[model samples]
Target: MSAIQILDLSNNSLSGKIPTCMGSFSNLHVLDLQKNKLYGTIPGKFAKGSPLRTLNFNENELEGPIPRCLVNCTMLQVLDVGNNKVNDSFPCWLETLPELQVLVLHSNQFYSSVWVCSKTKHCFPKLKVFDLSNNRFGGPLPAWYFENLNAMKDVSEAGTELQYMGEGFHQDSITVTMKGFEFELVRIITAFTAIDFSNNYFYGEIPKVIGELDSLLYLNLSFNKVSSCIPSSLGNLSVLESLDLSSNKLVGKIPWQLTNLDFLGVLNLSENQLMGPIPRAPHFDTFGNTSYLGNLGLCRFPLSKECRSDETLQPPSKLEDDAKSSIGFGWKVVLIGYGCGMVFGLIMGYLVFSTGKPQWLIRIVEGEHRKKGRRPNKKRGGRRG
Candidate 1:
C-alpha cells in the first residue's frame, strides 16, 4: 500500500468513517471514495510533500469542515466533495495549490461569502471548472473570482491532440447543468470551461468582466437575487453555448447585442422584470414564450401580446372612458329629439297640400289674414273721421 500511486474505492456499499491513516501514503496520487455510504468528517491530516493529485469524496454522507491540513498536498489537482454535508465557508486557501485545476463543492452546506485573497496575484490560474451551486453562500457576486480565472480566458491550443483531465484507470465525472438539464460528463476535456453559481443568495449586477471569458462554454448564474440589466458586454462570449440568468430581479430590455451569440443553444431569462419588444434575430426566434415568461411588460413575436409602436395611441384610462361615454350618450339623445320633431312637421304639411287642403289648416291661415286687413282699415277710417 505504501508504494501504491492510486487508491480508488468508489461506487461500493462501504459505510462508516474514513480512516485517518488513509492519508499516510507518501506516493498516493489519487484517492477516490465517492458514491458510498460513508459518514462523519474527513481525515484531518495528510502527509507532508504528499504526491496526491486527486481527492474525490462525492455523493457521500461526510460532514464538518474540510481538513485544513490537506493543503500539505501541494500537488493536489482535483478536489471534489460535492453532494455531502460539509458545512464551511469558501476555501480561499486552495488558491495556493499551483497544480489545482478542478474544484467542485456543489450541493453542500457551504455558506458565507466567497472571499478571494487580495495578494494572490494568480488564483486558480489553471482552473477549468468551478461549481458552487446548491449551497448557502450569500452576498454580492464575486467578481474577483471571475477576474482571476486566467485559465478560462485563454484559447485552447489549436491543432493539438485533445487531452482529457483524467485519462488513466480512473476517469473523472461531473454533473453539469446544461439547457436546464443536469448531465454527468463521464469524460472532461481539457478545454472545457464552465462556471456555475446558481441556487444561491448572490445579489447585485453581473460583472461586465464576465464577458472576458471568451473560452467559456457554460455560464449559469440563475436562481439568485441578481438585479439590474445584464451587461451587453456578454455578447463578446462568442463561444458560449449555454447561458442561464433566470429567476432573478433583473429589470431592463434584453440587450439586442446578445443576438450576436451565434453559438448559444440555450438561454433562460425568465422571471425577470424585462420590458419592450424581444430582440429580432434568427437565434431569438427559435426560443419560445417560456424563455421570457413572468415578464408582463415584454411583448412581440413568440408572445401573444403585440408590441405597440411609438405613433400608436394609448388606450384611455377608466375615468376618461367613462366621461367620454356620458358626453356621447347626451348628444345622441338631442339629435334623436330634433329628428322626430322635423319628421312630424313635414307629415302635417303633406296632409294639407298633398291630400287637398284640410279645414284646420285653412282656418289657421284665414284667421291670420283677417286680423292683418282689419288693422289697416281701422287705422284709415279713424284718420277720415
Candidate 2:
C-alpha cells in the first residue's frame, strides 16, 4: 500500500492493532478507520511526513497519550479521534500546527488544568473548527485562548508593543460553509467558542465576556455545578443557534434580553432552579415542552399554561357568590337531576296520551258520524221479519 494515495477502512469489523508497516504509504492523503473495533495505541510514526491531511480513528478503543509524532505532520488539516479511551494531558502540541483546520477531541478521558496560551503566543493559528467537549478539564478559562484575528486591525491595535513576533506576521482567515450557508470565520476574541465543559466538576458563574463572540453558533454548559444569574451578555451572540444550560444550580429569572436572539433555534434551561414567566418571543414560540420541562417555576407560552396574575390570586368579595359561580360536585349533581326529571316527564306524558282517551271526546265525534249514516239498517230488519 506504499503507492496508495487514499485508503478508507471505516465502518468495518477490522480488529487488532493497525499494521505499523502501513505507515510506509508515502503518498497517502486520507486514512480513515472509524467505527471499527481496533484497539491499542496509535502508531507514533504513522503520521510523520506521509502527506496525511485527514486522519480519523473515531469510535475505537484506542488508549494512551495521543502520539506526539502527529505534531510533525504540519500538513494535517482534520484530526478526529473522538469517542475513544485516549488519556493524556491537553495536547499542547496542537498549538504548533500551522495548517490544522478542524480538531475534534470529545468524549475522552482528558483531565488538565486551564489551557492558557500567553498573550503573545499563537495557538492553533489556522484552526477553524475545534471541539473539546465532554472531558474533565477544569479551572478558570484563560482569556488568551481564543485570539480574535479580526480584532487585530493593525500593528498598533495588536498591542505588540509589549512583545513583537516581528513584522510581516499575518494570520490567515478561513471560510467555513455549514448547513449550506457560508459563514466568514471569526476567531473567539472573547470566551464563547463551541466549548462544552459540561458533565464535569466545573463551577462558578458563566463569564460575562462569553457574549462577546458574535460568531459563536453553538454553546452548551449543562450538567455542572455552575450558579448565579445567567449573564445578560449571552444575548449578544447574534449568530448563536443552540444554547443549553440545563441541570445546573443556576438561579434567577431568565434575562428578557435573551428573547432578542432571533436566529436562536434551540434553547434549553431545564432542571435548573430558575423562576419567573417564560419570556415571550418569536424564538420562544417555536420551542415545545422539551425545552423547559424540568423548570417547575417557569410558566407562560410554549408551556401552554400561564401563572395567575396578582389580581387573580386575591379572594373574592363574597364567599357565597364565588361558591355559586364556581363549578363543583354539587352543581354537577343538580344539573344531572334536572335533566333526568325532564326526560322522565316527557316519557310519562307520551305513554299516558297513547294508553288513555276521554269518553266525552269520543262520544261527540261518534254522534256526528251516526247522523251521516242514515236508516239503512231498518229495511234489512223488516225483510228478515
Candidate 3:
C-alpha cells in the first residue's frame, strides 16, 4: 500500500468492495472505513488523483452514487458519510472541492431541491463546516446556497447564520426584499453555517426572516409537520447556540422575546401543542423538565402547574382579591374557634346539670339517699308525726 499514509479500516469486519486497488495509494491522506459492514460503490479510482484529505464512510452499508470522481480530490478536506445507505442528489460533485472543508452528510438518502454548486461565482469556496443533517432534504432553504461562498471567508468569520437557515437576515450582496423572500449579500459575512432540516416532511410557518442571521449557532427544526407561532423574530439570533422546536404542531405563546437568546444552550420546546404562561426569562429559567415535555398548554414556573385563566400565569384581580381575603381570614379563624367551643360547652353543661350534685357528693348521696329516701321520706315524714 505504498507505505500507507493513513488507512484505518474502522470497526472492521470489513465486507466487500472499497478496494479499487486502494487507488494505488498515491499517498492516501486519510480513509477510515467507519463502523464497517461495507458494501459497494465509492471507488471511482478514489477520486482520481487521490491524496484524500480525510474521508470516513460512517456506519456503512453503503449504496451507490457518491463518487463523482471525488471531485477530483482538489486537496479534499473532510467529507464524512454519515450513517449510510447513501442514495444520491445534492452531492453537486463536492462543490468542486477547493481544499473542501468539513462537510458531513447526515443520515443519508439525499433527495434534494437544493445544494448545487459548481463554482457559480463561488460555492463551497474553501467552505467551512457544513452539515446536511438527517437528509431527505426538502425545499425553501437556498438563499443563494451559502451566498456564493467566496472561500466562505477563509473558513468562517463574517456575520454568521447559515445553520439550516432558521431566522434570516444576512447583509452583504445587497438583495433585501423580506417577507416575499430574497436575501443575499453573500449571506452576510459567513461564519455560522449549520443546516439540519430535521426529521423530514418540512411544512410551513417559521420564516420570520430568521432574525437576520446575526451569526447563528445551532438550530434544529424538530420532528416536522411545523405549524405557526414561535417567530418572535427568534429574538434576533445574536449568536444563538442551540434551539430545537420539538415535535411540531406549534401553537402560541412562549415568545417572551425568546429571552433574548443570550447565547442560549440547548432549548427544545418539547412535543408542541404550545399554549401560554411558560416563558419566564433567563432563557426559560435555565430550562429543565425536559424542555417543557409534551407541552400540555404549558403552565409557568417550571411547570409545577397553576396558570389557566387564559394563561400568562393569570393572577391579578387584586391578586384574586388577595386570595379571597386570605381564604376569608381562614374561615374567620375557624368560625371563631367553633363558636367559642360551642358556647364553652353550653356553659359547662349548664353548670353541671344546674348545680345540683356536688355538695361533698351531696352529703354522701344524702346518706345513701337517707336509706332509700328514708322509706320514702320516712313514710311521708312519719305520717306527719
**Candidate 1 residues 137-247, lDDT tens each?**
888866676888898899855357887787865577777877667798878888888999999999998999999988898999999999999898898998898899999
- Clashes counted in candidate 3 amount to 14
Ranking by TM-score: 1, 2, 3
Q: Which window of 10 residues has the lowest lDDT sum in candidate 3?
A: 170-179
**Which wins on lDDT, candidate 1 or candidate 2?**
1
Scanning candidate 1 in windows of ten residues, the lowest lDDT window is 310-319
Cand. 2 TM to true fold: 0.63
The worst-scoring run of ten residues by lDDT in candidate 2 lies at: 164-173
Candidate 3 local lDDT, 129-224, one digit each (tens): 566656777655444554554443243454454543112421111122211233333332335444455766666677775566555565677777
Task: Please identify model 3 stretches exceeding 4 Å from their true place.
Answer: 2-19, 23-40, 43-79, 82-85, 88-104, 107-134, 137-199, 202-219, 226-240, 252-278, 282-385
Residue 169 C-alpha lDDT in model 1: 51
What is the total number of backbone clashes in candidate 2?
A: 0
lDDT, candidate 1, at 357: 86
Best by lDDT: 1
Q: Pull out the clashing pairs in model 2.
A: none
